[model samples]
Target: MPTSEFDLIYRYFSSLGAGPAVDLSVGDDCAILRLEPNERLATSVDTMVEGVHFPEDMFPEDIGFRAVSVAASDLAAMGARPIGMTVALTLPEADEFWINTFSQGIAQAVSEYRLPLVGGDTTRGPLTISVQVMGALPADKALLREGAQVGDLVYVSGTLGDAAGALAFLNGEWHPEPDAAEFLLQRFHRPRARVELGRELLGKATSAIDISDGLLADAGHIAAASGVSIDIECGRVPLSSALNSHPDSESKLKWALSGGDDYELCLTLPEEVPTPEGCTRIGRVTKGQGVKVDQDIDFTAGYQHF
Candidate 1:
């Protein structure tokens, strides 16, 4: 075992973060970061717990990668560009191989997002990882959840339900074809934050939220925040081939509606504005409150952390 916590940090987590956005990194009590002129900082945190958030036996590297990616998804929702992150890791004890693999996963996400690992803490406890991501965007350009207007059209980036499908498979609800199984599994393990697409919507999207919960639930958030009702066209919800291959149509649709963890962005745009590339128009904001779907689809709940 490592002699001390500092030794563990130095050996595994220290070198994973290095970049211009960070003025001072892991060795300090606090990370010093620099922001360009006219830039506003955005920060969000997400914590993953073993056996609750993920399967206890999942690969250590996958757990690390997911911790960073899920945290960055919040920044993506606000149309911010990620610059730095701090990971507070808890473990039962120091396992050299586990630490190395986990750090490698974090390094991969850090490199892909161009974020520096700034600073965090490590302690002995039940396995848990909390990642805090910091990002920045031009002043007054964030896509907030409170900006939707009655006339705005609703759109979603990429397909939904794949992650949910993976969850179903894990729970032994259904089995998909071999190819679809792989695709769904990957979608759950490595969800993209849609950073570029979010940036593209900076001035275009009226309101935005990343789909950490099910579509209906997250959309309801925008509706509730903006004080406007959202009506979704269930037929228009996009599904991947993997999701489409599910044996039961209603079950598949339910997964898309309430299964959560998709990590895609759902936003509202002006009706006259053209839909951004890589996004699909699925609904519209209306004059009432709460979210209503077109189909008889009964599922309306999302993942809850209570």
Candidate 2:
């Protein structure tokens, strides 16, 4: 489709609210923002495309949630609490119904994270969503992936592999109860960023990375960034009942290791600090390179984007 002209702006993008920090809203030539004293701004943007990030037939709400969650994950990695957002969408057609549902999901996320939608753009193209998020934290407290010390303990929040299990269900390996199925699919569709935990750990953590990729891949990120080795105890990964009830825990563990899109935070904490509520210590940062799980531990390979 050719570029959409200016008239469609009001048709789709005009109704969004311009909440706090928005000195000038959309429809203006510029935007202005104000930050509280001593607050440091943290920003992240992520783009998702149909077929690459999600299924073509996925409900619009899920699409909206996933898009924003991806960006929120980045903020969480930096231990920032969200402040506001701008969304840019490109679609193949002007589907009012889809847009409405999508906006509802975005609104739900905004409320959930206590952030507001300040401004953005809407235009014509293949289905794509680009969300830019702004967050803030005290300058001394922001988390960094490079802050890990050799003796720090590694931890992750929530369960792993449920999203991968949902993909299996989507491919028809087996059927599950609707609510049970929904839980797994929800992880894939609208992963929850560990923002609350991130904020809680800001000054306490040595290093952190959000688990957008599977455990090994993301753990590897922490290892590489911090210049340390990570030894994860495979037995410690928290599996949702979804993964526990599966016929094979080994396969589930493997999937947990390699699957992407978990969106949970994988962090390094100085061993002296007790693990926070809701965080599981899955490993320790070491002196070598890469990630190591027990040799006997095994599961499906992590997400292979290629």
TM-score winner: 1
lDDT of each: 0.87, 0.81
Worst 10 residues of 1 by lDDT: 297-306
TM-score per candidate, chains pooled:
0.95, 0.92
Which residue pairs in candidate 1 have backbone atoms (N, alpha carbon, C) closer than 3 angstroms, thus clashing?
none
Q: Which residue pairs come into collision in candidate 2?
A: 214-259, 254-299, 254-300, 255-300, 258-302, 259-302
lDDT tens digits by residue: candidate 2, 1-306: 334544444445455545666666566765566777889899989999999888899999999888888898899889997877888889888766887788778877877786677778777889999999899888668888787889889999998887888887887875767777888988889899888888998899988889887888888887888888999998898888866777776677877887788898899998899989988999888899989887575343444531
Question: What is the number of backbone collisions in each predicted candidate, taken in the order shown?
Answer: 0, 6
TM-score of 2: 0.92
Which candidate ranks first by lDDT, i.e. highest?
1
Per-residue lDDT of 215 in model 1: 90
lDDT of 2: 0.81
Reference-based lDDT, residue 106, model 1 = 91
- Candidate 1 per-residue lDDT, tens place, 1-306, comes to 345755965777788668878888888678888889999999999999998888888888888888888999999899998889999888987887888888888988988788789898888899999999999999878999999999899999999988888987877777888899999989898888888888888988999999988898899999999999999988899999999998788888888877788899999999999889989999999999999987786554533321
Model 2: CA > 4 A from native: 1-16, 296-302
**Model 1, 180: alpha-carbon shift in Å?**
0.5
